[model samples]
Target: MDEKIVFKPIGYIKSPFEDVKNMPKSTRESMDVEAEMIINEEYLESMSSMEVGEEYMVLFHFHKSEGFKQRVPFMGNGPIKGLFSTHAPNRPNPIGVSTIRITEINGNVIKFNGVDMLNGTPVLDIKDIL
Candidate 1:
């Protein structure tokens, strides 16, 4: 059977990485790269319960990635591995998740770190890690 699922973005990211090539290679590299998640006005209430200093998983879409291969080099140039084994952006669903700690919340904007996604990435959802 074939089915379709649709999702609406609750927000978008504001990060220094305007291009994928300029993004950090790993989470360790992006830990200090501050970013912001600007929640849409309609979703502003969703942030009411989120607290600064708490960590949450941010699910987003890789808007620029177009396709994927089952097997590919690790980190662009390494031993080949299955797509599910690596963190490549190109995938069957082009969805991404990153864990970030909330540093500040002003209105509907959340300032955080641990960003590894490109600027303007559409945020699908946010969830508490616990």
Candidate 2:
């Protein structure tokens, strides 16, 4: 494996959360929050298999996160712990994964829930929640 890797966004999130502080602290807390995934036209064909009513694992880029601390407060206010032990956005690789439900799919747009991301966060990929 390479020491570094890169990726391009397959889509972007459209949500009411414009700021991190306003977004849900945990993925479960955002379970019912409505949001849209605006897929790129080039990837429309690939999205054909995405079924509505199914749960998916969404991987996204945490573009707004700053530097990480080796020890960060768990849950943002709990005891400080190793970064690996916490799901903090600030990390060496600012990638975030959330389990979301697929409520609707219209053309290249997917209307889903369980959003803990900001409005313009880049969606890296989607996988079946197995």
Candidate 3:
């Protein structure tokens, strides 16, 4: 089926990294960094089951990223590697997923660590790891 799939953002990320440059390579690399996921009011109920200290895989859009290349320099410095092999933001669908731990939850806001996304990044979904 040649149908297009659409998704609405459940929230937006508040991060320190306003630009892609100098950001950590992965969430694991930025465990010390703090961030916030401000869930839309309507989606607030969806996170009621979540608790502080839990880990969830957050899916988000690479809003600032553009198109992708089939081959790219690994880590922007290493030998050339296929796009899928690296965690580059550019992709056929500019979507990013990171497992982050909840540090605090207040009202519709979620404070977390392991931030690798840019400020104001659109969050698509959040899934429990276990």
Model 3 RMSD, rounded to 1 decimal: 1.1
Better of 1 and 3 by lDDT: 3
The local distance difference test score of model 2 is 0.92
Q: Model 3, poorest ten-residue lDDT window? A: 19-28
- The weakest ten consecutive residues by lDDT in model 1 span 24-33
A best-first ranking of the candidates according to their TM-score comes to 3, 2, 1
Ranked candidates (lDDT, high to low): 3, 2, 1
**How does each model score on TM-score?**
0.94, 0.94, 0.95
Model 3, 1-130: lDDT tens digits are 7789999999999999988887888987999999999999998779889999999999999999988899988877899999999988999999999999999999999999999999999999999997
Q: Rate the local accuracy (lDDT) of all candidates.
A: 0.90, 0.92, 0.93
lDDT of 1 by residue, 10-70 (tens): 9999999988878986666887879999999888887889999999999999999998999
Clashing pairs in 3: none
- List clash counts for every candidate, in order: 0, 0, 0
Stretches off by above 4 angstroms in model 1 are none
Clashing pairs in 1: none
